[model samples]
Target: MSAQHPRPGITHDNRFFWEGLAQHKLLIQRCTSCHRLQHPPAPMCPGCHCFEMEAIEASGRGTVHSFVVAHHPPIPPFEYPNVIVLVELEEGTRLVSRLVGTPPDEVAIGMAVAVEFEQVADDFVLHRFRSAASR
Candidate 1:
């Protein structure tokens, strides 16, 4: 999709994560106190209940933990039969993102995937997963 796609709402907590994606990097939040990795950056560490956190670069390699193919109620700026996936990253954190470059029938749980960046607009970029073997 292009600029017509809905843009992500950038905020203080997630700015770094989004910025990293624009640079073709996957950034995951880590709790400084417990060293636990987390996705969807939060204000505090879930494991230690601490506010100290840091961003760490991820390997961008993961396995498909789960997925779904949406074929009904198609939305604009998004392809139908979209393959949405929950990926368990090598870093021990999970991220929910779209899967691309593979057909829906081909997607399988525990499938190896690697992160890929798509420039949806001049100032916007999104991270998606694709078959690691295809890379």
Candidate 2:
């Protein structure tokens, strides 16, 4: 990971998610009232409109639901042709993250992937995806 890589802004609604990553765990938010899972943590459950929420550990397994290779307008602290992916987790929720350790051209929809954690800074960690077949 690059030292200059962008860091996530930790907030109360998603603090648990970030903390889980630091501990190398994939955590997802589940509505306590409706028992439905959601990502990009929100203050209230979208389905049941309930404020009750809880965190659940995910299997760290998912499939590539969608992806894109960024090759234009090179950005700093990031490599060219970065593979950004929308991974559909086994828990039925999706996470938007980067695909690492695999060639950009090799990425495909429905490709099995597993979560991998990287400590980008002393106090911060990020979740990334890798081909599950390689595990």
Model 2, range 1-135, lDDT digits (tens) per residue? 544878777899999999999899999999999999999999999898999999999999999999999998888877778999999999999999999989998998999999999888788899999999999
Q: By TM-score, how accurate is candidate 2?
A: 0.95
Across 1-135, the per-residue lDDT of candidate 1 in tens digits comes to 342989788888899998998899999999989999988998988788999889999999999999999998888889979999999999898999999999999999999999999998888889999999898
Model 2, backbone clash pairs (residues 3+ apart or across chains), number:
0
Model 1, residue pairs in steric clash: none
What alpha-carbon RMSD in Å does predicted model 1 have with respect to the real structure? 1.5
Clashes of each: 0, 0
Each prediction's whole-model lDDT (CA)? 0.92, 0.92
What is model 2's C-alpha RMSD? 1.6
